[model samples]
Target chain A: MTENKAFCSRCGVEVEPHKATCPLCGTSIQQTEEEEPTSYVKKYPDEPAVKTEKTGRTAKQKRIFIWEVVSVTLLIPLLITLFVDLIVNKTVTWSLYPISSLILAWFLISTPLLFPNILPLLYIGETLPPAIFLLVIDKIEDGQINWFLDVGLPIEAVVAVIAAIVIIGSIKIKNKGMNIAAFILFGAGLICLGIDFIVLKHTRGTFGVSWSLYVLTSTAVIGGFLLYLHYRLMKNTKLQRKLQI
Target chain B: MNSSNFPTKKTDEESNQNHIQKAPKKDWFRLDNAATVFSFVTSTRIPCMFRFYANLKKPINVAILQQALENIIDRFPYYKVNLRNGLFWSYWETNPGMPVVIEETKYPCQKMPIRKKGIFPFRVRAYYNRISVEFHHSITDGTGALIFLKSLVGEYLTLIGVVVNDWQDVFRPNQEPHYEEYEDAFKKNYQKNLPGPPRVSKAFHLPFKLEPKGVFHLTIGIMPIKQILNKSKELDVTLTEYLVAVYLEALQDILFSLPLRKQKRLLKPIRLQVPVNLRRFFSSKTMRNFSLYVTPYIDPRLGHFSFDEILKQVYHYMRVEVSDRYISQQIARNVRGELHPLIRLTPLFIKRLFGKIIYNGQGEFLYSGVITNLGKVSLPEPLNKEVENIQFLSAQSPVTKTGCAVNSYGEKLYINFGRIIKEAHVEKLFFRKLVKDGIKVRIETN
Candidate 1:
């Protein structure tokens, strides 16, 4: 006599090779189309057990492709704009213009739209350490006029980049809504700005209306008005009249 | 005190329900479920000057009126018992021999200068205009209340000098159509087209309390019997349908402070809750609450629907509801969950709780308004002439509200409304419209 068949893992029913799901309970039993004969025979009546490797591979490929495409699309434009002035015009050495343009675009426009929250980090990226580096390089490099970027900009630049990573990486723990990443990014940027202000307090003043506050107020007012209009229009519609519960 | 003698009518409604060895269903006030019984005794002290309505030119003598009230008390033996379970009922005790209790107290009816709450259900009321009624929501509704009002009016008419012979012709007690039986029986008896029960969809409650400028009692008389019956034919609907359609249309125009076409659509699905009598559900008068209801929904978007269109909808729904097939199906469906033994074994408290879930949760008996057509009034043969009209106005807003009470003796229809929402010009506007449509409506105030 033939040996009794083993139950499918997902549906708890006897496996059949041709069927996609158990006839009794309708649970999907297969995750892949093909398997080795030995693995299939050993597991059940000639039917392979479900596999999860396919799903993992596809997900990894998708994420890598998206990250690559988005980074190139974003960085390429700003890099070209900055270097267009430096390398092409040959006025600034080594075309440091490309890096500075990316930083500015990321801080003001792109970061706000992509994730309005941590946008403050851009100012910190552009300031603070560069100011200190200018003093240090001036003393060390025989007080050369061009030594400012070599010292000051790098420290400010490093802190801004690290802060963005810290905020965006922390958001990985939360499986939330789409705009959540943006909110976290904006928050991190804001904190970096605060740190930069503390560092540069002696030289510069953080003015009256902060960038974050201005953006939030305008957005809220527009959204509120739109919602109010929708409410008034829908209040007396036929759909509302038909509602029983 | 125990040998029972009560009139009985054997109908399919009384079929298969007597599992308890037929020991004449216990007196309503002495039922097995006694925990829920409540009692209120109201002592009325009045100069009885309102007796003018009771006895016009040759007023009913005070001694005679008292005797008449006692006679009614004696005839309805169920009215004599205290509030008890199973056989739930309520009544006022009338006695000419006992001393009368008359004291004046202020009442809060919207506007009517001053009017005393009557001695019975009118006085010791447990009803608030909004939210919930104190009694079990399952027991009685606006429709059943309509019947009760008509009966009270009939009783009042008898107290006067007039006799009530034609009351039966004018008012016929209709048992709730037991739809459990086959269609053959229904077709044979209830020929009118009827609709299914009403379902309330949207209820817009305004926080503003009514502030009436003035209130007056005006009597609306039905056109000549021939005229109304003829118009009813031309409209191809029942007299009730035509009247409601007219009023609903009028309310659409009047309820709003401003006039706008879109505003009319806001009042769509004007639901009307009509109560059906369940007297024949079982063969026992000992039951206090024996009525069920259905609602008919009308779309107000028809703007100004023709009298015929409104009448057809109303008449058809009423017919369908009262039809044998519809009634039986409803009964079978309502009874489907309960097996015989489970119904009997279920404790009263549990039953009441279940009732709350069913009535408040599932039942949509009250429509935008309720029109309780007490059908025909049945009174003793002699009291016809002394009575001009009988009007029963259900609560208007808060509490158990909606629907106008209508009672017709012949050519006269008594229309009653709460003082809060009643517009004075409507009485005239209503009559003018009716007369224009060849249906004469007369109004009188005394």
Candidate 2:
């Protein structure tokens, strides 16, 4: 009953409504739609260039803000626990702090999407408070590197590991990166850990330092594995090609 | 029975009877209506689609979906690994060796497209009772996914049944998953990757506590057509544009009744991530998952936007995303690259943390839903007669609490919604208005 004069884009053939493509000649043409234009851009880590440019946004600026917020907020509880650890060294074992710090950072900083609005507050709260504490701690402690060898460096290692995995993963998954800082961070943490294990354990006791070999061995294994991966990455040149964002 | 075994209808006219088959390509990657209605794009723990098959029988067997999924996953390895000692040509640019399973989600989707790991924002899931999937905006558009789903359904049918003719010319024969047809992917000339920074936003969109009112079993039958461009023009949009607007209007009415604000701030536009086909980009149709996304954000202003306006926007947006040159270049590059190069090397623990890094706060607008219209499905009539109806439903995981799905066959459109938002007002408003607007609306409960 309806006079359908729609023609297929692939092949110039008139087709009726709801007809997928031309019948006389098979051609893939678009279905007709007269809908409103979408001004909203979907949030994707790796947005297409046209999409990114259309929105007048860059992945770099956003990352700096997010990292500034998240990384800072994540530093808070660590400082708090550190602040708490200094006063009550006899009461609480120092070793437990890094584990707790890891927990707090992973749950608090890592997965803020689970808790929506409180996220920004969590960021601001994490930032200003910690900056003040670090200032005070710097004045109180003697310039000796004991804290660095003990609670301080371990906590840093945990933070670095968490940051690296998250940053690298985000870059790979979301398609934005400059996690060169994160790489240095995690790499430094790993190096620190190796140093702390070898030197601190030897300094602490002759017998206990034997366990450092195990740590060294594990690090070598991980390093070797990374080498294998780097080789594979070189072998597999697929990751180099980026989709037109 | 094989392709040769399909029944030759007495005439092309008889075969092309409003066969209720889904049109192909455009809107093939479109998703359900509920996917559009909500503001949050959902993700899952990755194991939901996996079900240990117990009694693998005829209908509702987990094996059908599982085997199909597994078969698809298994097919790419031969291409990924340079097995033939370089005797077989290797396209190193868009190699199949890229990790399809992301580190954190390990979601088994989208190995081809160089984007996020999981088909987050949207994906497809197959269950024992049903199969559902939600894909992000990076994959194919709705129309494209629909065509693929039909192909999947046809392949499923082929797996289950032996096609035959009235004269018994078609005979029983085992169908082998011949991946040989796809072996030459790397040798293709159209190889290149679009270079762009990842799109992340500063604004945060929160999920309005909504649940699936009910799961609607839209028994969509396919019409005999190579693709469904005809109906789209009649509807005045691309196939996805039309269906999405239909559902969006339906959702606006429903959300309007929910005692909510007049103008909400969290208008995380309903992002329509449709899959675009790269077959035109490919030298052959033998490759697996040769699709990408044409994502468009729908303004959830409800009744403010007309169907005509929405279509105009969605159609052009999609066209630009999946333009012929873009599709072919992506395919060429993908075929050239190697698979799982970095990811295969990364430890699982580190990989789990990867999603958090990239997705944590890269973008502002939250994705509302994903629609993949696999396009029209024209099975050999002999095979079509046996199918009561083929449905594609993703695992309705509790991750995001709401999702949408769509599959259409010619005149009949299936807008199956999977959500936990217990609001019927949206469904009621949609069904009523659809019929009022002359769309033959049908409702089914399964």
Candidate 3:
């Protein structure tokens, strides 16, 4: 049999015959013709046999399982509460609010976790459940469809619009932090003003912007400052230093 | 769900609109047969990837390498696309952003960072004196990726004032991305009118344990070219056939020693999947996936097979399978399945389910292991002088558990064996077998 090539003792692997130093770690090594092989031959170490568990779940699947377990666990309590309340009251009573709110919470949490890609659709999908749940709670409590169609629906619509604006803006402008801030502040200001108008119409019988003026003034000022900062950062060297962090 | 408010899937159109500032019509494209399998089979657990690396004489400049990577991206727009969901087939759409480049890590060919959708399907990493490019097999085959890596290095050398000429041998930067480069070569050359090749049954597999973190073991053996060539000549077979025969011998040795019942289950056939680059047989220069495989095997049920017998068998099968008619028939087999009327009508989710099943149940079971020979990698003179060695490593298959890739440069041939199992039984036996043949073997590990 021919001679085995020289190996780097530091690396515990063979190196090129011409190498004076290890290619991986620049350490000096010397090999002679009669050197014994330092590496293993027929057998590998028995301590670390590769893990052979075939049916182990992946990280994402594990996360999904945990979420499923949490949902099921929460469902049991909700079901117990509903059964107890229905049996005692003989009608849908105080349990209606908690059940509707729990379902609304589930939709909000699960939509972002599950269907994260299509945000616009998710924003719309998330809005309908909460608005409908509010209507359900309202009908059970007062036996009337009064404030839901007027105030709750409008507020949800505005919130959905603001969510869409933020999602689209963040997706479009990758590095424009100030632009995203300004867009969110501006959308939030408009949404606040719209909500105030809807509430004022319900309370005072007319569309008059009451508490919204203060929100509009503060949000407009902050939004304007953010826009100015964004433009100034685009033109100055100081922005680069801040961005490097 | 309200259909009016929810936007239609406009990925291609939206990408074009942002780049050109005009609303363009949707430009969805279908996944080719080779690419289709990868789309559904890829998870964080089992990503299909292969990596190639070049060792330089001096340390690599990260800045210049990153610049080279960015410059080369415009030329490979076929690889610059993002995956999208389609009605019956997953597709690719234009990626209007640059591909990511980073420094290499301790892990060489790990599962590609494909968890995030819309990320590029390839990555360029540099560390120490080595520059490695790993590609998702969905994006391109070895030949195509090798061309890209060579061109990127060539561009880097030129930028650093190395006296390099004739990038004409490889794909040069600033060349317009051609439609032909991305064309599904299998589809274009498919003989729909001809009959398909004979179907394959389940093949043998190794009952090896795998690493928990999905980590793989890579052992690269460097041997002199002349020693192997002389042995091949003496045996009257090609170098690949000689190597395949040796690999077969190692498997047979393991097979006969196993308990009788276990042997009966695992000893159906010892098949080696030799990926045949189609560029040699066909005249197409497309950089997309265009390679096919021929499984050359030995049925243990046919009694004992000596090394020489295995060599002759591999030599004959390679000769028959590498021919144009047989390769075309194989292509017809794959194309016919895709062109099936019922398959065409299947929904995307259902198709993905079938694709996953086919990948795990069919793709993995049909081959015991894979051996891919990149032939030889040569650079222009000054650059070649700067580069010391080249290496290629493929991810270990979940089923096969090990794979072998070969790359040669100068007088050195590098055989990289990647396996998920901790024990290096096959590699140790193969190298020992080489040493027994009077060939000097130098081994490296990662």
Candidate 4:
């Protein structure tokens, strides 16, 4: 079978037999007498005309739906406790604890679901909830936040700062490998020292050190060894040559 | 399924069976140097896949094609593996399942769901009169894919009662695969301590709006091979150099057509990434990604360049860059990067996170566009008569927006442009220039 062809009068290039206009310049093609449109087969098949049905919920929609369900589920217990406390004691006295805990739970769960790609928001979600929960408990028990300020917030701040350093350092490092472990180890050592300092100050009303020194020494040694291996031993050209694939 | 009906001799079949049973199965393979980047950067937008197809004179028979695929798959044992994730890097594990032949999709080079369990890195697809193989770049490059396609078409033709006597480059189904065919040639030829090629400045990108995800536009321009070759001969340059010069001129036209302020703002070098097949330089038979690219650029800031000037630049640039010494420097750089202790020790997850940044910074950011030519394709005697033409389609890149693949079969030279952008300015300009230069072009789009 012979294939029929058409050329664009303006462009002087052959167009597909089925096309009425040139694909390049959109100029109309003058069909010849011998050209039969239906005689030629398309080189590639056309896209299916029937659009496939959208049957399932999108990922974002599903995440939002789950968050709504969790919110409602958490809300039910909070509402029940609030009503019971009001009915028995004529105020939101005992319900505050459950209410605060439920709010903290919702914040933690929704943080990942809503701001999953936003790292700073997720970090805030992780660090802020416990501090708020502890402050609320401190106020509820003693009508002040002295312990929350001296021990709770300080310890949380130390952990958050160290965790941030490790995470950001890991991302920023040019060649990320054993050095990440070293960063984590060093961060852990700092956290131990921070915890010891805060607890000692809060308990004994003086600044001093304790068991954390041993922990700090051990972590520093390991962390230093990892650093040495990563920077010194691994970077050696001779070693790399020996290990080359 | 009849043994006597097949091409493999009875003795060869017995030996192949024995080899399979006696050989220790390599359950896993490390990603080659070129493939390591693809493994990390490949996603739905950038599938990192390419397609090579052959158009036969007759409609394809699905059952016979399936049999042909099964018969020939063992000869390409490396391609039969599936992608698996390891601690330090991604690997290819032996996949025991057979790749089923499926009907061709409306689109070409769609993302292979390789991360899914049991999914092979390459797929065989058949359409009305065409049979295609889409391979993830991790599995092979264009040369390897072309070899695989030729073999498959040969096998298919043979099953359909055509005698294929010329199996010079074609891997027959009955033949045993050589160990060298599966070796990583990049690692094998790497020379340490050599300086890498000079760093390239960021090149100009097409100012076209990206199409939606999963949308790839293909425009193919077909012309007579003799006409283009004669034109290239008149210009005193090879066909590749002629085509690249035309491509560069097209980009220059687009850049100058824009508003002056916009042109100044986008006044970067127009560098085309032309991939060089390294097997020609180094005597290696490995069927993996053993190719590097030479970026022939024209700086718009210098001055307006005529077509002749661009051709001169591309011709000389290609001459100097497509040499063994220059290519070895590239291989050295790539192998060195892969062998660095920190890079080797870095966990796969962390590498994946940084891979996109690295790819953007060091990969596509350095080139304006990509044009890969597979040159002329020739099949053996009787099989050649049954085949009409062959087409190569490169994968769509979100950054570069357009890539061109060129190959010739018989008398027809097929230039396919794969784009992920809404505009077809590059395709239009490139083809119109060819038509204007007295070479007839037939256009088809998908």
Top-DockQ candidate index? 4
Give candidate 2 regions above 4 Å deviation: A1-245, B1-193, B197-208, B211-236, B252-262, B280-288, B298-303, B324-347, B354-365, B396-403, B409-411
Identify the leading candidate in terms of TM-score.
Answer: 4
Per-residue lDDT over A1-245 for candidate 3, one digit per residue giving the tens place of the 0 to 100 score: 34456665544546655556654345676777656644432211223433434675643465467668768876876788799899999876888777777777777667745553354667766887887887887788689887888888888888887877665665555444365568888888889899998899888899689888899899999999987877665543434323210
C-alpha DockQ for predicted model 3: 0.06
Per lDDT, the best of the predicted structures is 4
For lDDT, candidate 1 versus 4, the one ahead is 4
Candidates sorted by DockQ, best first: 4, 3, 2, 1
Question: lDDT ranking from best to worst?
Answer: 4, 3, 2, 1
Lowest-lDDT window of 10 residues in candidate 4 chain B?
B1-10
Worst 10 residues of 3 chain A by lDDT: A40-49
Q: Write the per-residue lDDT of candidate 1 for residues B199-218, one digit (tens) a residue.
A: 45653222123322222232
- TM-score of each model, paired residue for residue: 0.41, 0.46, 0.64, 0.73
**Candidate 2 chain B, poorest ten consecutive residues by summed lDDT:** B82-91
| Candidate 1 lDDT, A144-240, residue by residue in tens | 6553454345445555666556445434433222223344445445555544544454235443334545555554555455445434543444322
Flag regions of model 3 displaced more than 4 Å: A1-245, B1-28, B113-115
For model 1, the stretches where C-alpha displacement exceeds 4 angstroms are A1-245, B1-57, B81-200, B203-208, B211-223, B254-267, B279-287, B301-304, B324-366, B399-402, B422-432, B444-446
- Model 2 over residues B287-354: C-alpha lDDT tens digits? 22344455565556544566667667667776676666655544443433322234323332333244
> Per-residue alpha-carbon lDDT of model 4 for B253-273, expressed as tens digits?
999999999999999999999
State each candidate's chain A TM-score.
0.27, 0.27, 0.67, 0.60
